[model samples]
Target: MTRSIDTLLVANRGEIACRVMRTAKSLGLTTVAVHSAVDANARHAREADIKINLGGAKPAESYLLADKIIAAAKAAGAQAIHPGYGFLSENASFAQAIADAGLIFLGPPASAIIAMGSKSAAKALMETAGVPLVPGYHGDNQDYETFREAAQRIGYPVLLKATAGGGGKGMKVVEKEADLKQALESAQREAQSSFGDPKMLVEKYVLKPRHVEIQIFADEHGNCIYLNERDCSIQRRHQKVVEEAPAPGLTLELRQAMGESAVRAAQAIGYVGAGTVEFLLDARGEFFFMEMNTRLQVEHPVTELITGQDLVAWQIRIARGEKLPLTQDQVPLNGHAIEVRLYAEDPDNDFLPATGTLDLYREASAGEGRRIDSGIEQGDSISPFYDPMISKLIAWGSNREEARQRLLAMLADTQIAGVRTNLAFLSRILAHPAFAKAELDTGFIERHTEQLFVKPSTQSAHFWKLAAAAWALSEPKTTRQDDPNSPWANNCGLRIAQPRRFLLHLACGEEQQKITLREADLAGVCLTNDRLILEQHGQRTSHSAIRQGNTLYLELDGQIHSISAVDSIALAEAAAHPQGGLTAPMNGSIVRVLVSPEQQVAEGDVLVVLEAMKMEHSIRAPHAGTVQAIFCSEGEMVSDGMVLVEITGDAA
Candidate 1:
């Protein structure tokens, strides 16, 4: 029953689509890509042999449109559509539609997806299959009272998760009974927005649990095997940030047990293709089934690296009615591999998703156990229409230490501009003592927050010198083309009878500083190919620096520092607006406007709710004040830093 796949269509975007295309093209299969309007010029679309523009930016308007995707696949002559995780990957209806259209869905059957699609349903199925599960309510009752009673029965500090959701959306940890109502409502709203389902289930919020998941592959012939396990304990907002294969401190017996359980879970649903069974392992080695991801996991790379197998290729083979690549004992546990997700976000500001051009995007050189899987290039725009993930940096080594060090070096070699990123935060996490000692759990980030979160401080003296040197050595841009003789035409401050000196006002983070740059200070400095070399007082230092307009992005001490030159007008505006103005942190649609014109509000009160990157963010009051004006309405799309509400602070 094996059918040849002459052409393949990837019905998703970003790294996963690009990743699948790489393998498909290598195997001599013509690849087709379907993109939204915003992704017309994206890397995934550009790499494919043929591309179809689905029209629109939002997921619901584009990638999630299953019929449009199937039609595009047919029009492109693709025999199979690979829903590469996210979008319609785990969607049972989308899978059924592809099958109904007589096209192969490079994933599990619709029936399998349905069995494990909902967390509540999956928990019940796992319970029936003799898989250990945390005590909770998984009933059909969607009333608030039902959830309330369930939470009470489950005791305080319960976890509420969307029945039809993954990736932390529609999930919340209610610490007490008093906060259950609001938490439930917020979770339901997020669930409805992300998965179109407001149904939720409650479970005990396990303390200090390690998130370990097994990678299982099944074929149409009923052959099933577990590739290995990945520890995705390092997370933020319930989304995995760092993942690694051969979970630290996992014994051979424990691994075998988990792998067997995962295989059973997959076989129980008559699953085929790649899937993941997530488990929460406690301190005493007790494990409980969390849920099953019916599609490939985002952290699949770690398993591939450890097992030396292409899970995507296995999926394609399985869809073509082939048997499993390896048996239970044939799965290899080679070395260790680690992956960290690089995102366009502000870690200092609650990891809020950032959007803008990738002004100066650069990646660490791949090879020698270092791999960078990304779908973005320099000068690309990170739109609000999709995920803010820039790339996933993966490193493999002979052991965990080697892998961790390689990843740290990779982070140091990477540089990004235009938007804030978590590169520095990631570097600190890898360098942290606790992480080095394998003190990992779901609360790893919070448990070691003080060490992982670096506070914003003033730039160092050497940093100022480097910034001045880079600026002085770089060619200045023309300000006025019409009048070459005008004083404004000369960007460099050139006086008629004095040494050249420039007055620079720099803004870095929240600290602003003024520096006087003299030509003599840059006498022994040079900038060639964006590499800055400075020899000051017989001390030589080299750094990578990129100058874009009035902004200078310099990599100093393994951290990227974005410093902008501010003019007098910018300074005046900053001084005038000393009171914290409520602005959209990122490009997103306004979900709720909680305040009105001239409304009095207390400090820390939520002013507006904004939905971006599939998560909700609150624009809270900086201080007690009176809302002078409301400039934004609910459901309005706003750009980053766009002022939504203006408030006059009380006398301060």
Candidate 2:
């Protein structure tokens, strides 16, 4: 029953599509790429053997249209289709459609997809299969009143989740009865938009639980095996930021239990291809089934690194009806691996999604045990129409400590220009004490918000010196053979008795560093009595100077320092209104205005809800204050730090 698929049509876009195409090409398969109008120039499209235009910019008009994908497959003469991780990958109807069209679908059967597609149905099936599950209501009752009553019985602090979606969409954490109604409505709306299903389920919110998941694979022969586990507790707004294989604090007993559960769950549905079984593990070694992602996960790279296996290759072989190549005992995991998601976001501003052209893009070299999976290139524009993920940086080491150290080193050398990113924020988080010790949970980011987003203190002396140097360097030089009117000659009366003076102004974080420059040359520049040398090597320049006009650009230690010149009058005005605060983190639509003018609120109070990247984020009050003015209303679009609201404190 082994059928060979010589050609593959990749039914997706971005990094995952490019990733799968690499594996397909390695296997000597002719790859066909399908793309929307906006994605015609994308990486995957250029790398594929053949390309088909899906004909629209919006996802629904192109990528999400099943008929369009099916037609493109037929036109391209592709014998098989590989839905890479999203779009139609988990859609049972799409899978069935491919089969009906007489094309091979490289995934699980339609029956298995249906069995685990719905959250409610999946929970019921797991319960019957003797799998541990969180206490919640997954019944058919869809009435709001019934859900409210169930919430009351489940006690306060419950999680309302959309049963048909993943990726943290349609999820709400209701702390008390007062917020239940609003939470439910919001969750349903998000669910409908994200998964085309509004039906949701209520579950007891597990406090401080670590999010872990097991990767499992199965073939048509009814044999399934688990590829160990991954710890994904470090997150922001329920989305995983960092993930590692062979979970940091897992014991052998717990690992075995979770692995066994994952295998049984996959076997229960007769799953084929690759899938992930997520679990929520409490502090006391108790774990509950979260949900099954019936497609290749975003964090699969780390699993592959430690397992020394190519998961994409396995998926292809399994789809070809190949029997399991290794027994359960033959499968082994070695060393440790960690993966960090590099996203186009401003971590300082509530981790808001950002979009812009990639002016400078360079990934860390994959030397030794490093791996980088990137979708963008220099000059590529990061569009707002899709996810804002830039790339995934993965590193493998002999142990978790070594992996952590290597990843930190890799992040430090990583650089991206032209748009705000979370590079600095990620570095801060990785250096945190709690994270170092593996003391992580979903709320880890929220708890350390201040430390993570702290602005660097300005260095006045360094700024002054650098500015003076730049001003001196910009001064006109005189040539002995030049006339006074010559362009190379100094026009003003040159006095050999006194040194020339230039005022320098440098601004750093709301303060100005002013200095006077006298002379500057290849030897050094003088700021009053202090002198510093200048060095130029290759692309890097180093020098020190005084502050000048509102901008100063200097080079130091092989790095360029650009500081804007500050206006003294403007600085005074800004300092006078130091308490006029609280701004939006990024450009997004204001979905909900939680507070009104003249309302008294305490620090950390919910102020507004901003929606970006198909996710909702709550903007809170930074300090206790009386709302002085409201600048935005629900449904209004806003830019970063637009001052959505102004708060006045008693001290101010």
Candidate 3:
């Protein structure tokens, strides 16, 4: 049946939603966007030809509501629904529902999704298909005794994985027998909480394994092709942080073997559209099947850059019952491509997700070999209801070095503010020599932990000067009349000379500085020929500056600096009190509160568990103290630095 897909509805958000719509529109298909209440003004929502309101922001109320999504698609007269990964992308019932609703589901079949839905089931199927399987227990017994026996048989140093989970959730490593019980319990709890499936599979943990995956595409015409492999070894908390196509260290023979195995896995289940067959490459050059993602991956950009074929376009075409664009021999695997996920996370703070409005967002030129796939704009909000990824920055080069260098330059040039980002942290990782040499593993981030998580230093002198100039320029004509106590007030002039001295307070990260500028510097701080020339401190520095509201983005050297004017006194006062207070580290929802008023708590006791951007963060007591007050309760949304609990004094 060859049905034309005229109207396509995308049931996702963030970068992926925008990414899918671009291809759908390119194919001349009308794009319909579904947005939650909180995401009504999101970039993805605004980018579509037609928009449907899902009524709520949380996934449960919006993206995860299968019935609502189908209804929206039907209401918009969409011919097909494209589940852009995550949410209900892999839900067998959702696929069946879409099919039953007489709308095409731009993904694998419901049967294929079911075959690979659970880790245990998928491994069994792989073993049956004559593919290499890792040494593990993939049985039906979920009892404690059965698990204990499997762990004992598998020996020490094993991994407990949730059968129906991904994204490092519901996973744990037990190195010793004594820790097996607790590890299993924790893994099962997390698994049940995440996937509603506590069933587990025990596997022998590879000492040092490279996380490699092959991108596979299939058509409804019984044809499949492997588009080569991606090395997603650079990870944090078991989730891929950086990915590159054509995994660096593999020889031609091993690559062929891996690619063949991936095709076999895909063909066995009759996979349609884009899918990834993940494998763990051990130090001995041997590979073992890990799992198969039944949907398009988050790091699919690298694969597309290398193959020169749009995976999203292929998905749409296949959903419309079109044949494969090319055979295996026709697939081009040229050039090296790399992608880094730009997340709104604080690397120094245990990589906790940060949420807030993007006070200033500026991206580098994304053309030709450089690209930034993002759904955020200057004023977009990174809410706590979904993934914290701001974008995926992809760079392509003729060779590995060229691609690495291009990504490094782009990472430095990317400018984002309002919330703490992993920008500086990503720059350090790419600059590391180990990464440059392609020596990577799943533990790459942990191996170079000391160097990669360095604290950000103060902004350059030129940036501060630019910030001062921008603040001065933002002052209104009625600045003196707006507030009599204004620093720039006419009556507050200590020196009324030709070059008036103005003191401006600014805060950059953790450091605050008071920069004094003269009237001559302000007069000469002019934008001429698209360049901001500032003359201050007897030094002249000229750079490109983009001013938006109180924020000033400066391009100094090759790096981008986002600077904003802030009150130094207000920041100092916040830092003044550091005792007996529990403040939310980032904007998040209070998942659990463990303390009460007047309750004596021990030092290091967990007082709250905050859920932000799908990651849980524990708030611990700084010292043993008596709880004086509890200001916030569980399920309540709290902003960054909002005090949740207050203790009077240290416990006796």
Candidate 4:
């Protein structure tokens, strides 16, 4: 039996919600967007035909409330609810609820999701179905002795994974016996917070393995197919950051073998719509099933680019009881495609998530085989309620090298300011020799740390010189004829007068500098549309500049630098205080305060642990000092740069 869907409600936020709405609209189906309180004016809401207010900003008060989402869909007259990846996408109860309400769930059946709900249970099912399982203990016991015994049996370097974990939460790699207890406790606490499950699985860790996944789809009828594979080996903290289709060095025979196994895994569960079966390819090319994601994946765009098929559209059609459109052989994989996730996080500061207004955001030119899938625009804030992934940059070409080349240019051409991002980090990874050579593994990013996390030289004299000139020339009367005091307004745009020098103050991160600029140093000083253009030594340069309050952002030379403008008065006031404060690196909840008031601590000693976007970051003592005050407490929500603890240097 088949039914037509006239409207779809996307039960998610940010990029995925926006991504789903695009396809739904093109199909002539009305799209409904459900947003939290914070996303009242979000891009997804603007793109959707109908918007529903879910009232609260946090997931608990908004997106995670399945009842509220169903009510919104019903009120908007949506025939289906599409859980885009995160919130309730893989939730078995949510799927059942949708079915109970007689609304279409644009994903696998509830029974299938339950089949693969727990990692340990999923492994048991895979083994029974003749699928290759990674050697590990999959049991119901969670005692300390049980984990210890299993780790010893599996040998050293085992992985403790939360049975209900995804997106790398509650997963840790322990290299030796000494670290087992601490790792276990940390994984348990994280798993409890993330998935509400304390159960875990101990797996024989695969060293130097490649993380690969097969995209599978099924229809209401008895038909299914695999859309080849994607290599997601490049990661940080077990979360995938870059993904590509048609893994670089995989042979066709192996691809087919793995694809069929993935099909079997899907068919065994009676799965429908889009799903992913993940596996780990070891050094010897042998593969073992890891787990199955019974929902749409975050990296589904790369698979779509290579196959030239719209996976989201397919999911919609499948929910309408349409049969699989293509057989396994008819599924075409035209070329190679690569996708990099752009996050609002600082790579240098342990990749802590950032929260702030986008101040200035400009994408590279697309439609030339470069695709940008984003959920943000200029001036939108990256709120603390959800994931910090702002956009995805994807490119396709006839081969791997061509795709890689396009990515390098696309990333370099893109610009983002205000909040700190991992753009420079991504560029460094793409330019690395190993990444270019396609010698990839799950540990590749950590293995070549020095080559990938390049530190920038922010104190260059030439950069300061340019900043000073740009700042002074940015004055309105500098180029207008109405003001007679303009230095270049009357001298035929030439610096024929005495060189007038003025100090231009700027600050970025922890360092601040004031550079003196004279009119004689600038060749071309023009401010047009908030951009500064000039020539130096026959080379032209361009920068997109925006001044918001005391902060100034300059996007030039393939990078965005954020600086705070300072004046003599403000500088003097800051110097008078002569005190340094420790601030929260991102929007997060304070897990615990490790030090008491007036507690003496040494440099590098851990003071507080903050959790944001599903990762823990330690706030350490910057120098040996006494803890003068504590501003935050356990379980308190804090915004970015909110001072958490104050420290005063010990009297020398």
Best by lDDT: 1
Models sorted by lDDT, best on top: 1, 4, 3, 2
**Candidate 2 lDDT by residue in tens digits, 501-549:** 6676756544666676554422343333112344445344324332333
Task: List the candidates' TM-scores in order.
Answer: 0.94, 0.81, 0.88, 0.93
lDDT of each: 0.88, 0.79, 0.84, 0.85
- Which residue runs does candidate 2 get wrong by more than 4 Å? 455-610, 617-652
Candidate that scores best on TM-score? 1
| Model 4, position 343: C-alpha lDDT score | 96
Report RMSD (Å) for each prediction in the order shown.
3.0, 6.2, 4.2, 2.9
Off by over 4 Å in 3: 140-149, 152-156, 174-198, 456-500, 518-547, 552-580, 596-600, 648-652
- Please give the lDDT score at residue 116 for candidate 3: 89
Flag clash pairs in model 3.
none
Which is superior by TM-score, 2 or 3? 3
Clashing pairs in 4: none
Candidate 2 structure, TM-score to reference: 0.81
Q: Candidate 1 on 327-380: residue-level lDDT in tens?
A: 888989999999999988888888989888988888998778988889989988
Better of 1 and 3 by TM-score: 1
lDDT of 2: 0.79
Worst 10 residues of 1 by lDDT: 470-479
Name the better of 3 and 4 by TM-score: 4
